[model samples]
Target: MITYSNLGKKGNLGNQLFQIASTIGIAEKNQQEYCFPFWEYSEYFEFQFKECSSVENWTSLREKAFNYYDWEVSHGNFDLNGWLQSERYFSQSINKNLFQFKSDFEIGLLDKYHYLFARKTILVTVRRGDFVNNPNYFQLSYKFYLTALLHQFNNLQEYNIIFTSDSISYCKKHFSFLPNVFFLENLKPIEQLCLGSKFDHYIVSNSTFSWWMAWLGEKKETKIIRPMKIFDGEYSKKNDESDYFPKRWIEHNENEFKLENRYWKLKVYGYFYALQSKIQYDLKRQKKIIKNKIKDIIGYK
Candidate 1:
């Protein structure tokens, strides 16, 4: 049997797929086999072996496969030259050679958390560096989300919100005021201990770091919420989908807490690390406009 782990962005889409794959036991068979598209137009996919003759079976089998699903705008046409080339390449190669268990065992693992949090509890996750210009955006979102969650889950008295990310220090600096949210400064160690458990409703930011939290917390019907828009521009507003969540699970957005448009324009340069391609696009458009103005001043060549 094969068990594979996710190496994608740590939020909703990644988390949902991870839960589906783990529950289905698709990653254990060929742990080493994996693939990710490098082209800007390519679709993303996750695959792992279900069974094999030996661990070395995939020595000759290439893991490359095409996936055409386009759920997020970020996955649309992008300039590969603008991406964090090194990190993108590295993330593509991430594959875990772990064991696969029956779906029953997977449910059992998730049950550990259910048993621990016997009382009603709300589990919220925040990703660090989601909004570089408005550092407080996620902080505010968490506050509003927590408030709404408490209101919805009337009996949810105990709140155990866990925050996990690459930059726990940064997240801590901004979100220290929350009353009872459990903040794990670093995620790697916690992942080893919990082995993916604990969490009820996952309030994920735009980052994929929280994907595993939602995936591993699926035993008790987890609700995963993410942003309708990651960047600021005309968002093409429409009806909110918070009402579409499962009864046992709910996905609500704190769009009311979204940062103002003025602040978003101020974010053109500082987000190179977070939204690299978009930054490059911004720079390119700026350069083109500059060139056109120069031509107007000096008379075109």
Candidate 2:
């Protein structure tokens, strides 16, 4: 069975995407042995690490499995691309397309149910890519976004901002502005039930879970807010829409927040990539230096 760990180095949602893609890919291969979640554990890696060591040998193997997303299937044990090219992956993509057809399917589902619901429905999603490699990065990051959003939309109404986050405990602890906002552990189940009805507007962090939710939501004229920059910096409306909004909703970056990697995984990866580039550059420089020294020593052109 194929298993994944810290998919994209993020939590549940990240892992879910990887699982969906991999499941489709493996199913295409007609290899019944290929199964996702051979074991289902809820705790994060650190929490689960000490308790579960039975599958320790599969760590490197799983990384090789996900590399197929980038088409780098050079892993000796398996042909990742071949698996992705299989019928299942393409079929899954097609299913998603059809599923998205609801965006144009008459009156929006949100209006149907949540239009006059006493509690205001605010779609909340958090992004912590910078914190994916860091510990509790999303925790701190979510608090920042949650507070900012509440303050920005303070006068909206007596609202209930239904938040979706991967970190349940963090949400429970930080977001206690009762009668105002609440947190849902994950949006996957919400996405399933909300085939028609969902949030009125989406206040999304730099996270893919919210991006897809807002995209899939059947709300017309929903206010979709995102961070000014993906992890940092800034972006134009077009880029933001293309990157975050999958449907006709407006994509606006109302806030700009710094990228915080509480665990420093992002920083670590950045340094890793930068170091690799510098090493290559230095190697070339050294080669040039050696060639010049040889020419000078031999007195040749």
Candidate 3:
């Protein structure tokens, strides 16, 4: 059997999806019985698998798992607590509908947001609630958003440009000057994601919240653009070296990585082989997954 849980900060639904996606991958790859935790937003899903029992007594994997999914680990009872953020863990096949909200909730959103889907919509996801000035995180300059938007639209009048943000005031403050842009209000967090999954194109921010929206919203000729730096500090995932963001997605403001970002400590200290191994050995096997999460969200990007 395999089970997943969030051992990180509470109320982070995007990180929670990564935890869910990875566990589902490991379970399906090995054909093991799956156990996903029932946390916030559990009530929204139409669960297909049996309800997961508490994994408190289960063995935390002892075998080595090099991949993000831990699928390589010998088949045995294990509880998966890794961040497992890489798409390599679960590609298009492993339950694409895993995150769907209840039909009633979706119908309500559709009835209200029908106008958004009517036109060729460009969904701009702005995320700056907790990340505004938190030294570890970042706020994307207005320049990045405008650059991404202008890259797609020659005359902004022809297309529907919409802004959806956790902080509506921030979006208003930065993008309000633009013509014909509208803000979605009074949306619960999950509702926002459900709504975003239907938009035509996206200018995604560093937030994994928006990442999921753009990912779920993909279609033929759909444009998905993101910042070169994901999370500013330790959580950053560089676009060039990683498949953490899909190959099809375009990334803007690459200089942020080459210039302002100083998050990669391995490079900061000079990559001494001895130092790297010491840090690896110092990490406790089970809990080390959490630290690996902080570095690259627990695997090769």
Q: What are the lDDT scores of the predictions, listed in order?
A: 0.40, 0.45, 0.69
User: What TM-score does candidate 1 reach?
Assistant: 0.41
What local lDDT does model 3 show for residue 197? 86
Q: In candidate 2, which residue pairs get closer than 3 Å at backbone N, Cα or C atoms, i.e. clash? A: 109-196, 133-265, 134-263, 134-264, 135-263
RMSD of each: 12.8, 14.9, 11.5
Summing lDDT over every window of 10 consecutive residues in candidate 3, give the lowest-scoring window.
254-263
Candidate 1: residue 134 lDDT (0-100):
45
On TM-score, the leading prediction is 3
Which of the two, 1 or 3, has more lDDT? 3
The parts of candidate 1 lying over 4 Å away from their true place are 1-121, 130-152, 170-179, 189-196, 230-249, 257-301
Stretches of model 2 off by over 4 angstroms after superposition: 1-97, 100-117, 127-144, 151-156, 185-197, 231-301
lDDT of 2: 0.45
The TM-score values for the models, in the order shown, are 0.41, 0.40, 0.74
lDDT of 3 by residue, 41-98 (tens): 7777765545566777777753233234245545777776555666777735755677
The model with the greatest lDDT is 3
**Mind giving the per-residue lDDT tens digits that candidate 1 earns over 214-297?**
444566455566454333333212322222222343435554444445534333432443466447656776898999999999
TM-score winner between candidates 2 and 3: 3
